[model samples]
Target chain A: MLLQAHSPRGLGSLLLMCALGLYLALVASISLGPMDISFSDSMRALLPKQSFLPSELAPHIEVIIRQVRLPRTLLAIAIGAILALCGTVMQSLFRNPLADPGIIGVSAGASLGAALSIVLFGSLAQHYPEVLLFATVPVCAFIGGALTTVLVYRLGSGPNGTSVTMMLLAGVALSALAGAGLGLLNYYADDQALRDLSLWTMGSLAGASWPGLALAYASLLVLGVLFYRHAKSLNALLLGEAEARHLGVNVQSLKRFCILLTAAGVGICVALSGMIGFVGLIVPHLGRMLCGPNHQRLLPLAALLGALLLLLADMGARTLIAPLDMPVGIVTAILGAPFFIVLLIKQRGRIS
Target chain B: MSIAIQTHQLSVSIGSKQLLKPTSVALQSGQLTVLLGPNGAGKSTLLKAMIGELRASGKVEVFGQTQKSWRSERLARHLAVLPQSSELTFPFSVREVVELGALPLSVSKLQLDDIVDKNLALTDVSHLQLRPYPMLSGGEKQRVHFARVLTQLAQAGEQAILLLDEPTSALDLAHQHNTLKLAKLQAEQGACVVAVIHDLNLAAQYADRILLLERGNLVADGSPWEVLSERRIEAVYGYPITVMPHPRADYPLLVSA
Candidate 1:
């Protein structure tokens, strides 16, 4: 007996531990930076318990912690949660562990949408200085993402219902189409627009702002609760679409709802942090290995693990080359790809 | 006996090819009906059509109500299907897999657990309850699915219909008999049990009634002694077979001649 499947009571303890670990990672991410703020100072700066605490240090710490690091840390948690939760749902919906939003062209579609907004609306931003550019990009991205998802789903479905293989093929074709659109936008861009496009595509927490942070967190909470309630249905889906139907799950509606919601969530995350890859793919597998394949336990744990990993990755990006921030996407890919490969090799015996 | 399922001119077709011809039949409660046919003979197609999984040309009713009229959730409570193979991607334990059968029910947690536990033991999979479904042997996996479908019908009352598609295809001799015995036991308890099976001997021994299909047509429907005759078996199956009485059992025994 592997004895690896934890009891419900054991899973509760594991969740509590992961929650504590996530909190510690959040604290560490806020405190340690190029400025070398002490852990206590970071906490104090975050929560101002004393009004008069060494005025010079207080103001410096306050500026760094509040204006810069605080928003970044919170955005990391929200985006990470969104990506991982969506990944869990996508994997179950598609009936493949390898599935992620990227597999279905949502990320590519969002990137195309963002590229369009940045290149097309560049002049508009200057003329309409009062208009917030943040709102425009995400709205456009959401539209693009939703359109691509609907297209893929339509192409994949025929008289026999949704075909996972057809969906994958359609996704690849759409990703290529979006890539062409991005290339065209790249060609039409000026130097500044080109630079911004590159940075956004590479992905960074450097763009984190208070408003963006608030939007990301709000989406996270709402989507998290909704996805959590659907955990059992997702589990039934793992038994295949027909089996799920036999078990009284509304297979067609569940597939439609999950796909659209994931598209929306991934669209917002891409708009806020750009194209961060592999966090969605990697964290859900880790959650499964830790807590078994029960989605009731898997989804929440995946969210926590995703948040912790991304926060740590962002921290490494911030400090590894101090004063020159690396794109957090690179860190996630570097960390995620190797772990994914090792898992593939380990499961190779059963691959057939 | 009350009719558990009644099909009026139900037929299935794909493109221009008719898989099952228009056929009318009534399956009664307190009986186990086994569907026997050669490959591509429309046995599975008719079973799927009866459960409304496939679109048929005519009507199917469960307990005097149209199959289409019942909500899927409510219908699921009265009818359970064990497909030939269930595609599972995750590592669900046998108990968890069994517990999924209670999804459509509004039963309390204790009642649900009792149903799952009872079905698990009924299928003789109680010892394997903690084992991962994917890790089980082919026969064990079949039994786990058997437990799942059985649990699904636990609350469906006397008029319930259970459809099994090749429920013993992967099982060994002992397990095959054990599974059919459980199906018969369900019928004895007043649930209408139907199975599509390939084994002639098993069908002869277990089925209260046998339905023999040949190339999209029902050629025979009667008791085992009436349907499993040597001449008809050879004609429908296109192979020579020997039919003899079992020495210690009250059923016919079949052997290839």
Candidate 2:
């Protein structure tokens, strides 16, 4: 029965199906927008025209597709994937399903940095355009996210190294500190700066650009691949530190590697999308439900499902309210919160 | 293949508290060597030192090589340890848990499956293979952990060194015997087995030699008859114990004095 459950063909088929679904979802996402480009026109827009291209399918449409919407959609996918990957790594690192990138203050720290950029560096906004202004936010956010993670790790690690409980506590403390900093920034901001900071905190894909998408997606994919390769080692870690060491895993080194990878992944996602909540928490849980807990299967499945969910959420954010544009984070919270509650209720007996 | 595990003047101090005093002991190859002691006797500490899990003042040599000289993966390939408590955070299946034993072998999937199956059968946990490991009773979990250690031993072949710290604490009487019987069999097959046991009767039944520890010091080492004497058991455990000849074997059975 165990053999049947772990059949390579079965896993391969499931992965293939998920990959096909993601591809279909990506194409469908590209078909969606404020402009009503039909599926045929969208396909034609992607390729060279048989006849002379119409002015409607002009260079501007190409720019919108290639530069604007494509990057934004890709950012959604990358951010979603990175967030979910971080969730998986964090949960295993802490050995608790309750752990997520946000739990460790990475997102909150990044948000604080972005908030500070908006509030104190608001003058840069007039000097530079929207793209340049937004660029500074991610850079600052990355520094804040990475620094907070290092602090949490340092505080958590003992003489032997970090205990799971210590790490969890450190994360909570760091998150609270970040939240306090964010509150201070919010209180002192001018009206326009306050509005901009609020929007950034609420989270959106509107600021997604080619450079931003490139930075987010590239880091996420590389780290995600590295994580996927360490799936077996992660499984060894589930046995706890001593047993993992007995199994030839360098437990301390693996913990450090996981922390660095999770920090990078979470940092990039928060930088790109401005703290989209629940994707990191929910998607990995969903993956665990479907794939069981062998990370070899869980990591990739979680990445795909995460990307799909966020893409769908982004679509709803745009289409549900039309031109008004609800925040993508708000959309995810609305959809994800109830589902998370149900998961909690169902697993309440087992969870500590 | 002879397996000698020798701790040379080993000492462990944790934060100004001496957990294990400087002590030297040798466990001969192909013998069921039992470490007997009271609570806080540093039996577990000494075991950890032997496995290189804890940093110590002196050296542990596996066969003739210093433990530090052996790469961790290479050391794991030959040595298997069952810690006193294994707290699993994730709900891995019994099979997944057992498969970890073959990690040092870097076995192919087919070989890993075979090793897991055989070890599970040996530990009598084949029936529990599909069950969630964390959901099992303490005794059942201990059996599964034993299966994992056994799998590691089987993979390590003749050179395997099995180090178990109170492995039967959670088992029922029958299981306790069965588990020790499996250990004895492994030792007979030329693996060096060192087990920390509190039950003197079970130790008497299975062990080829016994080493008694008292307050982080080695107090006695000999055959069960030599170590399970009324005076020594009473002296170390601070309890009256009667040592009498077993009806079925040459070794002595220990009872309340």
Candidate 2 on A1-352: residue-level lDDT in tens? Answer: 2322233346667778877877887788887887776776666666755566454665667766666667778888888888888888888887767666676677888788877877767766677688766677767777787787778767765654345466668878887888888778878898897776766566788778778877877887698789988888898887778888888888889988887778767666766677788787898777766666789888988888888888889988878877667889999888777876786676577553
Clashes of each: 0, 0
lDDT of 2 by residue, B1-257 (tens): 36478888999998998888998887777899999889999989999888877888998898789988988888888888886668674656788888877777867888788888988898888998977676788888888998898777666766778888898888889989988998898889888899999888999889998888888888888988788889888888889977888887788987786
Q: Candidate 2, which CAPRI tier? A: acceptable
lDDT for position B30 in model 1: 94
The residue-level lDDT of candidate 2 at A68 comes to: 64
Off by over 4 Å in 2: A1-9, A49-67, A117-139, A150-172, A187-196, A342-352, B1-3
TM-score for every candidate vs. truth?
0.94, 0.91
lDDT of each residue in B1-257, candidate 1, tens digit only: 99999999999999999999998999999999999999999999999999878978999988999988989888888888887777785777789988888877788989988888888888898998887788788888888888998888877876688898999988889988998999899899998999999999999999999999999999999999999999999999999999999999889999999
The candidate that achieves the highest lDDT relative to the unseen native structure: 1
DockQ metric for all predictions: 0.56, 0.46
Candidate 2 lDDT score at position B243: 82
- Top DockQ hit: 1
